[model samples]
Target: MPQRIRKLIGTVLLLLLVVVWALSAMALAQGRVTELGWFLQLVCYVLLGALWIIPGGLLIRWMERPDQKV
Candidate 1:
């Protein structure tokens, strides 16, 4: 695939990923952490926030990978 096409697709995918991730996260946390202590809640939130980057990093690397010579 061409670089421009890959970038356009990557940008769209990233936006969709963010939207889905945020909504999924909120859904996962909603009313589920009410019983947890504040400190624990903070830790969970921090973990959740940072963990999404793993897959995103992989995707980005693939997206930016150089086109192979034919």
Candidate 2:
């Protein structure tokens, strides 16, 4: 597969993941927000915000890889 294709696919998947992740996190936190303190809520949001980077970075790295010689 070409690098361009890989990058394009990765971009699409990453965007979908971000949207889903945000919605999922919000849904999960909706009922519990009142029970959790502000500090914990901030921590949860912060961690959720940053957690996607691991897979995104990995996909980007994969996109950046050179095609192997046949």
Candidate 3:
């Protein structure tokens, strides 16, 4: 992938992760975990954390390079 596209994908993934985290927090706070939504919410939380780790790290590294323009 081109550098620009890769950066865009990474940024999007990171933002999605953040949104997922927020939704998960809201669901938990609203006591949705004990309901039928628990399974989906659990999966979402897991994926959210995972997505943020690898892609977010790569994006940060890419953005940090002196030669690259975001």
Candidate 4:
């Protein structure tokens, strides 16, 4: 597939991923993280904040890939 197409798709997917991640994270925070002590809550928030980078990075890498030669 073309790089342009890959980027377009990846952009959409990345946005969707972020939305879903944020919603789920918020739910988790409201449900359980809020009940935890301050230090544990901080750790959970930090981990949840950074966890989305893994898939987002992969999608961005795919988006930036050189187009396959015919």
Candidate 5:
């Protein structure tokens, strides 16, 4: 596939990933994280906030990859 097309698809997927991740994180926070103590809650929030970066980074890498030569 062309790099431009790959990037366009990746961009849409990235947006969807972020939306889903945020919703899930919020659900978890509201349901379970709230029961934890303040420090643990903070830790959980921090981890959840940063966790999406892994997949997002991978997606971005794929999007930015040079097109394979024919």
Candidate 6:
């Protein structure tokens, strides 16, 4: 894979993850925010955060491959 392509793919994946996380966080602000509810939402957020590592790691590894040349 080319370095430019790898960087583009990595950037797109990171952007996708950011969009997902932002949307998930924004879902909390519609109406009637609560303490316990927020806590649970935070737990869910953490879970999702952890789940992101797999793809994130893959993207990073792809971008970092020594064979890729820009």
Candidate 5, 1-70: lDDT as tens digits: 8899999999999999999999999999999889899999999999999999999999999999999998
lDDT of each: 0.82, 0.85, 0.66, 0.97, 0.97, 0.72
Predict model 4's lDDT versus the native.
0.97
Q: On a 0 to 1 TM-score scale, where does candidate 3 land against the true structure? A: 0.44
Better of 1 and 5 by TM-score: 5
Report the Cα lDDT for residue 51, model 2: 90
- lDDT per residue as tens, model 3, 1-70: 4666766776777798678867776676557544647678778567645655675677677755554456
Off by over 4 Å in 2: none
After superposing candidate 1 on the true structure, give the runs of residues whose Cα lies further than 4 Å from its correct spot: none
Minimum summed lDDT over a 10-residue window in model 2 is located at 25-34
> Candidate 4 clashing pairs?
none
Error of 1 at 21 (Å): 0.6
What is the TM-score of each predicted model, taking all chains together? 0.86, 0.84, 0.44, 0.97, 0.97, 0.54
Model 6 ranges off by over 4 Å: 25-42, 68-70
Ten-residue region with minimum lDDT total, candidate 6: 27-36
Better of 1 and 2 by lDDT: 2
Once fitted onto the true fold, the runs of candidate 5 whose alpha carbons sit more than 4 angstroms away are none
Q: Over the stretch 1-70, how does candidate 1's per-residue lDDT look in tens digits?
A: 8776787888888888888888888877786775799998998788778888987887788789888778
Assess candidate 4 and give its TM-score to the true structure.
0.97
Q: Report the Cα lDDT for candidate 2.
A: 0.85
